[model samples]
Target: MMVSYVLVMVIIIKGYGKRIGEYIDEECRREIEKKWERWEEKKRREEEEGVREEMELWREESRRRIGEMKERMEEGIRRRIREKIREKKEEIEKIEGRLELEEEEIGEIELEEEGIEEKLRI
Candidate 1:
């Protein structure tokens, strides 16, 4: 009877030890899963931040290019306007020169006619 009691007690102790070991293993698994989840969350946040930074950089580049293009277009327009004004000024000068020459010829003709009239009166 004593031997039987001892055997039963040994079996109960072994069962209790197995239960404890299993609980420890389950707790370890849960802890590892929690750590993995935290790591995944951190990685995801970093990726999102990187993507946001890239987008902002691209936006800035695009804005800069647009500004440069606008400036170039404005400069070209100003240059064209200046060229047109210069051409118009040159044309005006040419017209004024021709008018001056015609006036000088008219004055010469008037003097010749006055001389001819004086001779006729004499």
Candidate 2:
């Protein structure tokens, strides 16, 4: 309201009031245009910053997932190695059991032969 009163006073100054008022109007329009341009530039920069931050977050997430996958793969490999080792151990135990049985049978046959030999001598 104060600005409007001041403009009214300037417009009723003299016969040159119209020209002066037009000049002031032109200056005000230029200032308003400059302000709008600055505001738009600020908004554009903020949007660009937001997009950059989002992209960085996405990249970090991707790296994290990749790390997790790599760890899982390594663990799987280790588990497979352990399983193979267990199978080899079982196979060795079975071979040892068979050998023991064979040795006992051989000893029994030797004792029977000795007894038969003593009976022939008598």
Give the top-scoring candidate (TM-score).
Answer: 1
Off by over 4 Å in 2: 1-23, 103-122
Clashes of each: 0, 0
Model 2 quality (TM-score): 0.61
Q: Count backbone overlaps in model 1.
A: 0
Candidate 2, residue 65: CA error in Å?
A: 1.9
Give residue 21's lDDT in candidate 2 (0 to 100).
Answer: 91
Q: What is the lDDT for 18 in model 1?
A: 90
Candidate 1 at residue 121, lDDT? 92
Q: Which candidate is the best by lDDT?
A: 1
Write down the RMSD of candidate 2 (Cα, Å).
7.0
lDDT of 2 at 29: 100
State every prediction's TM-score relative to the real structure: 0.69, 0.61
